[model samples]
Target: MNTTSLPKPNSMEFDIHAKLKAANSHWSYCYAVHPHDKGFDYQFNTTFVGEMEFAVYERIENYFVLVDFFKSYDEACDDAKKIIDDHPDIKKMFSVS
Candidate 1:
């Protein structure tokens, strides 16, 4: 069996480019709560279907804060898993239903 190891993720993410778009720009996405969410309607949104369009996202306080646009959804999922596993408190603090 040939298995490749995933790259180590950083504790903090940095943005290389700032979005300098006009205010109130239109966006397209779907909002979904975390699989373990069981609280309020706080949710995360994805611009594309993860498996079909290869989008990965991170949620914070009812917002999909981090967008892995270029990264594959699978890769982004692996990284997100690492983050959640490393800090279990995130789920409890900001769980969405």
Candidate 2:
């Protein structure tokens, strides 16, 4: 019996891009905090689902790459600040520029 295969994702793709855009637009305002280094940054934002998340990014060249995620904003920021206060060169190690 010859069987037909399902269409590829891009062949008849749903409005996935639009959906993602809408979802991303609904997220709360983001706060960029913890001035680590020239090439390292930290930010925290709440999602549309009301979940809070913090992100750590490291810059390679012209763009930044996500390094890690944390759960609490206050906790993460406090911990990061403490680390920076204790060791100013911690974030500099991850910096590219």
Candidate 3:
């Protein structure tokens, strides 16, 4: 099987990383798509490392806290958007006026 024969994606929106200020601190919070690794598995390591997934995380001081993961890009983006839109603190963190 030649994986290279597959058509390229029409858009790269999934690769866009959204970084925002933490609600309670000066640290950063980000959500983005990444390839699966040994650390995370949706079904007991059934998925390979090449598989793409979305992750939401927060950086506090010198450490990071993983919030959630989504199998699809849309799912992750939607949830992040909802969180910002529905929460006053999160919404205000956005630089866009």
TM-score of each: 0.27, 0.29, 0.27
lDDT of 2 at 94: 34
Q: Per-residue CA lDDT of candidate 2, range 1-97, in tens? A: 1122222234543432342244353322233333454544433222323444444444445444443333333333333444434544544533466
| Number of backbone collisions per candidate | 0, 0, 0
Tell me the tens digit of each residue's lDDT in model 3 across 1-97: 1112122224644332222211122222332334443343121111234544334454433334444344333444544556445556534644365
Model 2 stretches with alpha carbons more than 4 Å out:
1-48, 73-97
Order of all candidates by TM-score, from best down to worst? Answer: 2, 1, 3
Global lDDT of each candidate: 0.38, 0.37, 0.36
Model 1: residues >4 Å from true position, as ranges? Answer: 1-13, 16-52, 71-97
Candidate 3: stretches off by over 4 Å: 1-50, 77-79, 82-97
Error of 1 at 64 (Å): 1.9
TM-score of candidate 2 relative to the true fold: 0.29
